[model samples]
Target: MPSLNVSFSDEEMEGVRAAAAAEGKSLKQYLHDLGVREMHRKRFVAGATAWADKLRGEFDEAFPEEIPPAQRGDGAAAA
Candidate 1:
């Protein structure tokens, strides 16, 4: 893989070193894993949000709540 020069503060470097030590990895490997995890996390959240907006209404019918029987069919209410 191509490499890039990145800078970190002393505190950040120490924390990364500690994490790498705990995981028995070099600092580069530890950061690589962390970066990959964050990338995947971002992708998952984006996909989840889109799916939620689309399918969220369907769940209400499958599991109706606080509504009378007459109201459950078409989301209208009994007078």
Candidate 2:
């Protein structure tokens, strides 16, 4: 694995150390988990957006009038 060098102010470093200790993780492990979780969160959002767009397009093509009155269950068009 590649190594990364990051700089932090003393206060910042102390805060990070405290946070890691609170979570029962070393600073390295805490940062690693944080990075991995952020990456997964971004990927999930992108995928969900794409899936929602596809579904919206399909739905618009199928129901241009916004769900059609017959399927509304109001029984006004049940004849």
Candidate 3:
């Protein structure tokens, strides 16, 4: 329902047209799909980052003062 106007250099326009033809799409359809995929990618990254941060916080709370395995002196010290 909405429209966007974009300009490209001659070389860039040719490259875009070539890519659309290679994918069996018109330039409009190719650009539209590219935009949709980029939107989804950004949302996925944001959600994944939030989930990782929450898990990290919980882990830190559960393991305050926990020594990493590499820093632990030896198997005997671990026991």
In terms of TM-score, the best-performing candidate is 1
Off by over 4 Å in 1: 64-79
lDDT of each: 0.83, 0.88, 0.90
Q: Per-candidate TM vs. native? A: 0.69, 0.67, 0.68
- The lDDT-based order of candidates, best leading, equals 3, 2, 1
> Which whole-number lDDT from 0 to 100 does residue 18 have in model 1?
94
Compared with the true structure, what per-residue lDDT tens digits does model 1 show for residues 3-37? 86779999988988999999999988888898899
Summed over model 2, clashes come to 0
Specify the highest-lDDT model's number: 3
Residue pairs with colliding backbones in model 2 are: none
lDDT of 3 by residue, 1-79 (tens): 9989999999999999999999999999999999999999999999998997779778878988976565688955665
Q: Candidate 2 on 1-79: residue-level lDDT in tens?
A: 8978889999999999999999999999998888999999999999998998779878888878786455778756753
Write down the TM-score for model 1.
Answer: 0.69
Consecutive 10-residue window with the lowest summed lDDT within model 1? 70-79
